[model samples]
Target: MDKVKFGVLGCARVFERRMAPALKSAGNAVLHAVASRSLEKAQATAGKHGAAKAYGSYDALLADTDIEAVYIPLPNDQHAEWTVKALAAGKHVLCDKPLALSVSEAEWMAGAAAASGLRLMEGFMYRHHPQHKKVFEVLRSGAIGEPVHFRGIFTYPATADHAGIRWNPAQGGGAFLDVGVYPLNAARWLLESEPTEAKAIAITDPTSGVDSHTAALLAFPNNRTASLIGGFDQAFTSRYELVGREGSITVERAFQVGESGVRVLVRANNSDTEEAFFFEHTDQFQLEVEHFAACIRNSELSLEPGEDGVAQARAQALVLSSL
Candidate 1:
């Protein structure tokens, strides 16, 4: 099997903790380079991640002939710009979630990818995790019997770092763009449709000029509705529940890791019983990298395409706008 050589577009903290290791461990991918505005950071990331090259400029990474793919962990606002540039340069792109700051930007990205005939994917790694697949299978198997409603919550208290990107307005910092995206994405993926209508509320930080907390109600087809909550002013909590006519599917840790397994507790209406589905623990990041490599090797785009990212972004934007 030929390994897909990967060039990382930034030395973002997310890459150091998650994506870099995933690329290193994946059997079908190689971490070939990392680029950052700072040469020191780029060199450090390259050394730590076994990257063959380090470039001080993003453009330099794009120029590498050996790198067929680029993993973009840039800021939320920069996603579309870099992705369009990478696609135009004839390199496959795997951009971070909330693919762009706006629907129009995301549309432009999708267009660029189609025009270039290069693989373009938004990084919604959780959808590739086996546990999520199990959730889909159960839903498809009628275990839940017509999933009618979904409730998702993701929250983690933010540090008082005023300069952090999550608190910066120019870089697209807000709870809705950060943790909020997970619940929104989960709802969309499970329902497999775009949100038709939305209402939302937000608590804003006067100092930071960003929403510290946000809650939204999304109306989908089939008279279905989903409640999504994301915040930076709460204790760590991540969970989602899908309620149907027959039973309910509850995921304990909807978007994060745990020791044992994610519970898929199923309960029928009249029965005082529950069936638990146990899934083996695996690194979701590694699974994501493997899937990305598979898509590239097969000369295909990602399972979670740029459009999915765009849709999630649009939903998030609508929620924010409603707030």
Candidate 2:
């Protein structure tokens, strides 16, 4: 199969530090071009990342005939607009998560992709990691026996810059829309059910109008519920627990899978044991990029398709509305 040609939509920190390296590592993907509102930034990113072309405008990058796909790492609110434009430009898109602020916008993005016959995928890198797959496997093995309750938390200190994206409400910034989506989606994927109801509270930054902390509860059927805690004002913590009738499971550093090992503690029937699963040092970003490239090459939907993105967006909107 021919390598998929890729254009990057921005010179965001994520692009420079993460996606660009992942694209370089993908066996069947090429970083063909990049764009930024500033020509200098665009040129610098293209040069640093070996992109063949640079455009001062996103539309110019989308119009590149050689570019078969585009990765949009734009702000949350801009996801829908750029995704629609990229699809209309005849380029498949891999957009950053929380695809849009509302389900309506996500549906519009899905419609655009369908009408254009172009693939559109939400960028959920952790889902592609093998460690997460192991978690799914353990859950399916009945080790956790009929999950009853879940507790998930993802927290980190806020960025030092006041102008950072996470502090910009106009950019769709907030604890729930940002880190909170990870735990929310993880719960949805593990439970294999959509949340029937959501309640959330937020501690907002008065100056920025963005949330600094958020706590939410998602109610599922079978009298089950998931507690989600996320914020930008706390020390680093990424952990999850699944409590079942027979036993329980706890995962540390649940969101990031690394080379060292993944710790999974399983307790059942009054017995407790732990095991560490190790895998090759694979970059989640590379795995995600490879998945998108394969989908674009085959004209198929990616693992986390637009529908999943829309579902997550709906859940996010529900939480936001409650707050």
lDDT of each: 0.85, 0.84
Task: Work out how many backbone clashes candidate 1 has.
Answer: 0
lDDT of 1 by residue, 1-323 (tens): 99999998888888999998888889999999999999899998899889999999999999999999999988888898899989887899888887888888988998898898778788877677676776877788886688899999999988867888889989989888888889899998888898999999888989998989999999999989999989999999888999998888888788886556666677756356888877777778888888878888886554653346667668877887787
Give model 2's TM-score versus the native structure: 0.94
Residue pairs with colliding backbones in model 1 are none
Span of 10 residues, lowest total lDDT, candidate 2? 298-307
Which residues of candidate 1, in runs, are more than 4 Å off?
A: 300-302
Models, CA RMSD each: 1.5, 1.7
Q: Estimate, for each residue in 1-323, the C-alpha lDDT of model 2 and write its tens digit.
A: 99999998988888898899999999989899999999999998899999999999999888889999999998988999999999999998898887888999999998998898788888878778776777778778887688998899988997745688878888888777788888888888778888889889899878888888899988988889999988888998888888888888777768765557566666765456655555566798998899888877775454553358778877887777877
